[model samples]
Target: MSPRNKNTMLVKLRNDSQWSSWTWQQKLRLHGKHGLTRFFPNIRRKVNEQYIKYIKSYKIEITPYLLSLIDYDSQGNPQKNDPIWKQVSHIDLLSNVKSADYNGVNLNWEMPEEIHYSILHHKYPDRAIIRLTDNCLGYCSYCYLAQRTLDKKRKTLSSSFQIKWNGTLEYLRKNRQIRDILLSGGDPLLFSNRRLDQLFKDIKDIESISTIRINTRALTFNPFRFDPELIRIFKKYGLTALEVHFAHPKEITQEVDDALSLMDDIGYRPIILWRSPLLKGINDSCGILEELLVKLYERRIVPYYLFHYAPYSPARSNLSTSVKKGVRLLSELRRKIPGIAFPRYTLFHSSGKHDIPLVQEGTNEFKYEILANKQYIVKFKNWKDNWVIYPDLQDN
Candidate 1:
C-alpha cells in the first residue's frame, strides 16, 4: 500500500507490481467476499443450511474498498444492521420470496418501433443506450438487472451487443436522429481502457450524436481506475458527463472525492451527476439524504434523480417507499434545502417520467389522494410542455 495523500485521506496511487498482480476477481476472493465465506465464522456456524442455499441462488460481489467499510468486531463478527451490509448482504426475509422482473425494460426487445437492433433500447427517437458488458465491480442487492443475470435460461451478454459493432454503428448513422448515446451495462468503466478508448473514438466522430455519458459505479469500488490515461482519453473524445450510482452518504468518502477531483482538473464542469434508488431503512430518511445531497453539490456532483424504488418482486417490495411517504420526504427536504440542492423524486414508467406530486396546497393535512383509473396530465412547474401522465394512482 502506498502512503495516503495529505490533503485527502486516500492512497495517492498503488505501486505498479501491486496493481498488476491482482485481477478484479482476485481482489474479491482475497477480501473473503465471493460467497457466504465473508460472513463471520460464528454466524456461518449457526446459520441453517437452507439459508446458505438461498443466498447462493443470486449473484453477490463486493470490492476491497467497500469491504473495508463494513463494521466488524475485533473477533471478526460482522454487524447485522450496518447500512452498507444491508445493500449487499443477503437477508433471511428474501428466502421464500419468488423472483420477478419489475421494470420490464427488457421487454423492449419485443417492441420493434424503436428497437432497431436486438441489444439496443431506443425508448425515444433522439436517445439510445449501448450495453458494453454484463460485469460490474460491485453488485447491489436490489439491482434491477439481477433478475436477468440470475436466470439461467436467458443470456445477459449477447454477441449482438459485442460482435456486431459495425452493424450497430451503421444503424445509428442511417437514422441521424439520435443526439445522445449512453454507454452502460454492469458498468462501462469496468471495461478495459483500450476497449473504452476505441468505443469513445468511434462514437465521438458520429455527426448526429452530440452527447455521450458513461454510467458507472467504479468510483465507489475502484477509484484508482480513473488514472491519468483514462482521464486523457475522456478529454480527447469530448465526453459529456458521467452518471454515478451511490445509495448512501457513507459511500461518499475521501477516495471518491479524489477521483472526482481528477475529472475537475480536465475542464469537466458538472462532470459527475448522481442517481440512486431510495431504498427503505438505508437512505430513506430526510436527514441521511439531505446530508448526502449537500455533500454531493459541494464536491461538484449534481444530484440528478432520486428514483422511487420499483416494486420488482414480493421479496424486494419492502424497499419501495409509498408515493405518499416519498412526496412528504421530498416536501420536507424542499422546505429546508435550496431548490438547486434538491433532486427530482420520480417514478419511471413505460409511458415516461412523472414527477411525484410534491404538495396539495389547500389541505392542511399531508396525505396521498387515490385517483382511480384516471389519466393524469402531470405538469412541470419549471418547464412548459414537459409532462408525463401518472400511470396509476392506486398504488399510492
Candidate 2:
C-alpha cells in the first residue's frame, strides 16, 4: 500500500468500528434479544463461530447498543435484526458471486489518469461523481470497502482522497462539459466544518460544477458533527447540496430529525438515501420496506435509492439478495405504498446505474429490483421535469 491509501485514526476506526460511548462488558450482556443465542448458537461464546469469522473479516468492534438489536429468541429468527442484520451477518451473500456488467453506466473517458486511484465514476454523462474523499466518521460491518481498507498496504490507499485532492480538483476545473458533481465516499461530512468549507469553496469556484451533492450518515450516528456552525458554513456554500444515507427506519431518530430540520434552517435541505442488502431473515419483506418509506415521508425527507445488497467484501457471502428477487420486492412494495414515500429503486453495478438490475431493468434507463418478481417498479410521474438538462446535452 502506498502512503496515499492510509486512513486517519478516525477513518481507521470506521473500518474497525466501535461505539465509543459503550463498554465491552455492557455489550456482552445485551448482544442479542430474547433467544438469539439458540438460532445463531455460539454468538455469546467467548470465541463463537460468527465472532471468529467476523474478526478474520477485519470487522470493527460492534457496539452493545447495536448488538442488543439482534434476535436470539427461538421465535425471533433472523428477521428480528432485519434492519441491521445484513450489515454484519452476511455470510450468505459472499457465497454467491455475481459478475458485474459495466455497460451504459460507464463513467466514460473522464475514466481518469489512474484506474485504481480515481475516485470519480461518471456513468451517465449528464451527471458526474467526484469521489472527493476516502474517509468516514464510522464504518459499517458490511462495508464493500472493508477488504480495501483492512489490508495494511491499502491503508494509505484509503486516504488517497487527500493525496489526489488537488489533481481531481484540477480535472473538474478543466471539464466544462460536466454540470453536476456528487461528493461521495467515506462520508464527506466526516471531516471538520473548516475542511468541508475548503472543499466546497474549491468546488463552488469551478464554473461547471453547478449542483453539489454529498452522501453521509453523520447525522444518524454522530449528530454532533451537524452543529449550527457547521450548518452555517454549509449555508454559506450555496453550491453544495446535502444527502443523507439511511439504511432503515430504525436509523432515523429525533436527533436526526432535528439535525435535518437544522440543515433546512441553515439552507441545505437534504435528500434521504435508504440502502441495505436483502438478507434472508433480515429486511426482504415488502411490508417492512413500505413501512420504512412511510416513516421517511412523515419526516419530510425525500426517499432516494432503496438498494439491493451487492456482493462486496466479507459480508458479501452472507448478505446479497438475488437480482430478480430484489426487483420483485421493490415492485410489490411500490404497488402497496404511496408515491410520496416511495423511493427510487436501484442497485450498484460496475456499469454505474444499471437500474432494473442483473435480473430485469430499472428502466430502458434503469430500475432497482430486488427479486425477479419486479415487485417495485419506481417511476416518477413527471420524471423528465424533475431535472433540467445541463443545456449542452439538450441537443445531444
Candidate 3:
C-alpha cells in the first residue's frame, strides 16, 4: 500500500479522545510512522522481515517533512547523487551485524552520582547538557543518542521536564562554573514554542550561564519550525549560539536557506555553527566537503567540529571511515579551502573531545592505546612521532 493509504488506515483506527490534542510525534506513533516502513513500502518489503527486526532494535524515525526531502528516484541507485538516501536509509549493515555500543557514551557514565535528574549530563567541568526531550523531529541513522533513547526500558527526559525546569535551574544556579548548557535531546526544537520560551527564560535569569547553545537538526527536518514567534523567543533569551548538523550538502535545501535567512534577518546575538560526522559514503570526499563548507559559509555559518564517525552503532558501521582518511580530507581542505571554512576534525571519547592527528601516513596500519587516565594514544605503523601533526584542541 502507499504511504498515504497506510496513514489513512492508521488515523481511521484511532479511538482515543485525546487524539486531536496529540502532537506531531504522538500522532506518528499512534500510526506506526517511525521508520522506513512509513515510506517506500516496496523497499521495506524487499528487505523482508529483516527491516522489521532492524527497527525493533532501534527507533528509526523519519519525519514527514524530512521524508519529503528524500530523492526517491535516486535512492539506493548508485548511478545518481542521493546523499539524503544514504543518510536515512537502512541497509544490509543493520541486518548483518548485531548492535554494539561503539562510542561508549552513556548517560550513567557522564551523570554525576549526586544528580538524580536524567536530563542533565555533566561531563566536563565548565559545560553541561540539559536533555530537553528524548524526541526528535526525525531520527538520524548515526545519532549518538540512539542506544540511550531508543531503549524502551530506559526512561527519557523528553517529556518529564516540559512543564518545569526548576530541577535543572537549581543545579545550574548552584554550580556557577557551568557557563554553558546545551539544550539537546531528540531535538529540543520539537517542543512547543511556549514550553521552549519558558525553559529558556528560566535559564536566562541565571547570571552564571552566559552561553545557551541550541542543538538541533530541525533546519533540515522542518525549517519552518523556526517561525517568527520562535525567533522572538530565541532573541528574548539572548541565544548565544546555534549548533546545527549537516552531514551532506544535499541536506541543504531551499527551505534550509530560507530558515537560515530568517535567522540572519532576525539579527540574532546567536552565532550559527555547523557540525557533522565525517561519514564515509555521505561526505568523505574532499569535493563534497568543500561544497558543503562553502554553502555553510555563504549563510554566514561558521564550520565547527567534524567528528570522526563513531562505529559503535552497528547500523552505521558502513558509514565509518578511517581516521587516516579523515585526516587526509581535513589536510586537503586546509590546503584548498580558506582557514575560516575549515572545521576542526576530532574524535569524541568518554573522557572529552580529543584531537584527531592530521598525520599523512603511508599505509592504513595503526594502533590505539587507552591510557589509565582515559587519554588515547594512536600510532601509525612505520612512522616516527615527529611525523604526527595535531589540530588545535577544543573542548566540545
Candidate 4:
C-alpha cells in the first residue's frame, strides 16, 4: 500500500468502531477489499502448513506514516521493500534455512545447555539479554532466532499484565548479575504500549539493569510503532536507549525519517544497528553496504554492526551470503568511510559473545574473535607483555 493509501486506510479504520475492535487478522481483510485472498499470490503454490496458516491468519497492516514512504504502484509488492515485509515474510524462508557455524556463526541455544534461563548465553555477569516479548512483527526469511521466536499463537502476552507475566519478572529479579538487558524476542515492539510500559517499569524496579538496548527492526518493520506516546512512556519509565536494526539504505525510508523526527522531539536517542543477513540476492555488494552506512551517518544514526548471516533453517544457498563477500565488503567500507559510520562488520557465532570480524589472516584464511569463549581462543592475541621488546614500558 502507498503511504497515502495506508494513512487513508488507517484513518478510515480508526473512525470505524468495528475496525478498531478487530484482531490484526480481521484488519487485513479490511485492508484491501479482500481479506485472506490478498495473500494468495505469494502463498498459493507453497506447501508449508505453518506459513500457510500464518498468512491465512496474519493481518497486513502498514500505517499511513510508513506507507507514505513506499512506492506501492511501481513495485509488485511495495510492502516487500518495506521493513514490514522483512518481519512477516522470512518465516517462509525457514523451510530453506541452514546452519550458521559452517558459514561462520557457531549456533546454539542455552536451552538444554542451561548456563542461564535464556535463549542467550553471555560471558560476563554484568550483562545479559532478557527476552520480554515472544512475538515478531514480521518473520524474516533469514531469521537467526527462528527456533525460539516462531509459533505465534502459543507465545505469551497476557491481556492482564500483573497476573500471567509476573513469572518472567520474578526470573529477572533472581538474576542480579544482569546489568544490561538487551531486549530480544520476536521483536519487543510487537507488544502493546501498555504491556511494554508495565514491563519496563518492572525491570527498572530490579535495579541491576542499567542500560536497556532493544535489538529490534521496529524502525524498519513498523516505524509507526514508535510514536510520541511510546517515546513518552519509554522516557518516563527510564528506558535508556533504542537500537534500530536497519539493513540496507533502501530500508531507511522517508517514513522512518519522520518517525525519527518525532523521537527527536521527545528526546529519544537511538543507535542504528546497520547489520544485514547478507542474503545472496538481497544485499551482498560492498557498494550497497557502504551506501547504507553513509546514509545511516547522514541521519546521525550510529552504524553498529554488519552481521554475517546466520545459516539456520531452509538452506545456505537461499540465505547465506558468502563469508568472503562479507569480509571484502567490510574492508572496502572501512577504507571508504570513517570508523564511526562503518559498522563493526561481524558475525554472531553462538550462544556465546563471539562476533567474528571478517578479516584477512596471513595464509589467505579469514578470522575474527569470539567475544567471550568458555575456553581462551585468542583470535587477536597481542604480545604487549614482551618487556625487552618494549623497554619504554619498564620505567613508565
Candidate 5:
C-alpha cells in the first residue's frame, strides 16, 4: 500500500474501540495464511499453493498491532516493498530459497561447539546469551535462530524456560569471566510478568553476572506487552538495557511512543537501544536509515548496531545485502547524522561479531578476495584477531 493510505488506515484502526480493547493474545490470533488473507484479501491471489505450503511448514505469526502497520495497495494486497510485511510475511520465501541454493549460500550459521543447552558462548568470554523461550509474538523470516523458533517440535514456554534455567545458571556460576548475560530466544519478553520477575531474580542472584540485557522486539511486535508490571520487573532487577529491533521508521508508531513514554515515566529511557539487520528492500536506503536513526535518537533510544544480514537460511537470501553496501550506507549516514545517532555496522560470524570498516579515501582496511569458482569473499579479523573469510553478496 502507498504510505499515505497506510497512515490513514493506521489512524482509523487506532481509533477503533475493538482494536484498542483487544489484548495482546487476541491480536496474536492472526496467524498463518488464513489470518493473513482475512485482513488482506488480495493476498489470496498473489500467493500460490506452493507458497502457502512453505508458510505452513515454517509457520507465520503476526499480531493485529503489527498487521495494522503494514501497507496495502488499493486492491487490499500488501505493497511489494512494505518493510513490515517483508520482515514478517513469507511471500518471497520459496524464491529466496531457490536463489540461495543456486548461489551456494550457507543454510545454517550457528556454531555447534559454542552452544551449551540454550546458551551460546562465542568469542566473547565475558558474555553469553541464554535462550529463555522458544516463542515470540511474531516471527521474522530472516531470523538466524530459525531452527529453534521455527522448529515443529517446539517446547512449551514453561518447559523450555525450566529446562534451560538449571544448566544455564550452572554454567554462568562456573564462568566468573562472563559478566554480561543477554536473555534472548524467540524473545524473552514473551514470558509472563510473574515468570519474568522470577527470571530477573534468578539472574540477579548470580554474582558473576554484572549486566542483564533483554533482546526483544516487543516494542515493535506488541508494545502493549510493556505494561506497568513489566516495567517494574525491569526496574527491580536493574536491566542494563533493552536491545530492541527497529528496522524502519514506519515501525515507530504512536503505540511505540506510548511504550517509550512508560519507560520515560520511570526514567528508564536511557537504557533503550536499537539494532537491526540491513535488509535489501527494507531500510537499505541511506535516507530510510537516517530517518530511522534520527527518530530513535529523538525518542532517546540509542541506535546501537546496523547489522549485515546473516544468511542463516536459504529462504532469507533475498533480504541479504552486500557488506560493502552496508558499510557505504553507514558511511553516508555518519556524514548526515550526529555521531551519537550513528551505529556500528557489524557482521556476526561463527567466530564472533566483527565491525565492518567504512570505505574512506585512503583506507585499505577492507580486504577482498575472489574464490576459485569466481565468487567474491571478504576477509575480516575476528575478535580473537584471527582472519575469517565471509561470502559477500553480489549486489543486484
Candidate 6:
C-alpha cells in the first residue's frame, strides 16, 4: 500500500479506537495548549510566548478532531495563515485593548430585563432562548459569549440570576405567545444523551411549543459525539431542524460527512441550517463565503444567516468587520449563487436582530453619517422602528 493510504488507515483506526474508548471527559482533559502539543507535534514549536499570552487572556479548548483539520508546514508546524487555525487561535495584533467586560455580564445582547430565570424572552413574542450551559467543546475566537465560556467560574448558571430549568419550563408554559424554544448556550449538543433525552421530552410536553431549535457547533468540533443513542433520541423527539455553526468550508471534513450519513441511514435526517459570524480575515471574503454556502447547499443544509461580527468586548474588536463590507460581500454572492444558497446578512443589536440591506440601485435604509468627533457611523432602523447609530469599523 502507498504510504499516504497507510497513514490514512492508521488515522482512521486511531480515531475509531478513541471514539469507542475515551469518554467526553477524557477527551476534554486533553484540551488546551498542552493537548495541542501532545496530540499534534506540528503545533509544539508554534506554541510560543505570544500563544501562551493569548491563551492566558482567552481560554483555549479545541477538540482533537477539530485541531486535526488545521494545515501544517513541511517543518511540522501549524501554518500561520491556515483558516482553521485563525478561527481557533488568538492573534495579538488583531486585538490590543484589554476590556473590563470579560465577565460577560454586560455582554447579554438579549437584554437583562427580558430574562426570566435562564430563559431569554426575545423582543419578538414568538420565540424564547434557554441557556442550557455556559460550556462548549471548543471556544471560537470570535464568540460573543467569550466571558461566560472563557471564565471557568461562570460555567454554570449564576445563583444571582435565579435561573432554574423548572422555572424556565414554567415560564414557557405560562406564556402561550411563545411558539418556539431555542436551546442555546455554549452549545446544547454538549449535553449527554440522557440529559438531551430528558430535555427533549420536557420541551415536547409543552403543548404550546410547536418547534424546538438547538444551536450547536458539535458537527465540526466533534462529529463522534453524535453516536447512535443521540440519533435515537433525535428520532424519538421528531427533531427535523438543527442550526449548526460552520464558519468556513475547511470545517466540513470527511468525519462530518460520515456523521451526516449515519443520521441519514437511521432515518433521522435533520434539516441542517447554517449560521455564522462574518469575522475579519476569517470568512469575510466573497469567494470564501460563496464556497462555504455552496458546500452547505450541496449537503442539503440551508444557508440561514451570515451575522455581522459583534464586538461585545474591546478584546474582540479586531475580529469585527465593517457592516458595509459584510453587505457588499452578500450582494456580490447574490449574483454568483442560487437564491436558496444565499444567507441573510444580519446584525444582532441591542434593539433586536435586523437584516442589513444590500447596496442596490433603489432607495436604501442604510445611511452613513460623520459624528462631531469625526467618527464614521451607519444609521439603520431596528426591529422597534427606532433609528440606531452603529459605529463603522472602517478604521479598524
- Give per-residue CA lDDT, model 3, range 235-335, as digits (tens): 88888889999988878888787777776788763788999988877799999999999988887889998998653553444666657677878888888
Q: For model 4, how does the per-residue alpha-carbon lDDT over 1-396 read when each residue is reduced to its tens digit?
A: 444344334445446544322133223431332422342334333433544454443323333333333443232233444433443344344343232322222333333453344334344567766565556654455556544554333335434435434654565677787788777776777767887787778778887767777777777656666767788887787665567776657678776888789877998655545455665555667777777778888888887666666534323445465555566667766779888887665544333333444554412122322333232112321223221100000000
Residue 373 error, candidate 2, Å: 23
Name the runs in model 1 displaced over 4 angstroms. 1-26, 29-34, 46-52, 91-93, 96-116, 149-153, 158-161, 265-270, 313-315, 360-396
Q: Scored by Cα lDDT, where does model 2 land? A: 0.52
Q: After superposition, how far is residue 361 of candidate 4 from its true place, in Å?
A: 4.0
Best model per lDDT: 5
Ranking by TM-score: 5, 6, 1, 3, 4, 2
RMSD of 3: 7.4
* Candidate 6 residue lDDT tens string, 1-396: 322222232245456646532254236433555655554455455455566666655667766566566665554455667777787776453346533223355553657778777546556799888878787877777777766676544546645433388888888889999988888888788777898899899989999998888889888777777788888888999886789989989899788888889898888976789999888788888999989999999999999999877645434556677777777778878889999999888877767777888863213577867788776667888777788866666543
Estimate, for each residue in 211-256, the C-alpha lDDT of model 5 and write its tens digit: 9899998888888888877887788788898999999998999988
Worst 10 residues of 1 by lDDT: 1-10
- What's the distance in Å from true for residue 183, model 3? 0.8
Candidate 1 Cα deviation (angstroms), residue 229: 1.7
Model 3, position 304, has a per-residue lDDT of: 94
The CA lDDT at 200 in model 2 is: 82
Reference-based TM-score of each model: 0.79, 0.67, 0.78, 0.70, 0.89, 0.87
Q: lDDT per model, in order?
A: 0.63, 0.52, 0.65, 0.53, 0.74, 0.72
Worst window of 10 by summed lDDT in candidate 5: 98-107
Ranking by lDDT: 5, 6, 3, 1, 4, 2
Q: For candidate 6, what is the TM-score?
A: 0.87
Clashes of each: 0, 66, 4, 23, 2, 0
Q: Against the hidden true structure, what lDDT does model 5 obtain?
A: 0.74
- Candidate 1 vs candidate 5: which has greater TM-score? 5
lDDT of 3: 0.65
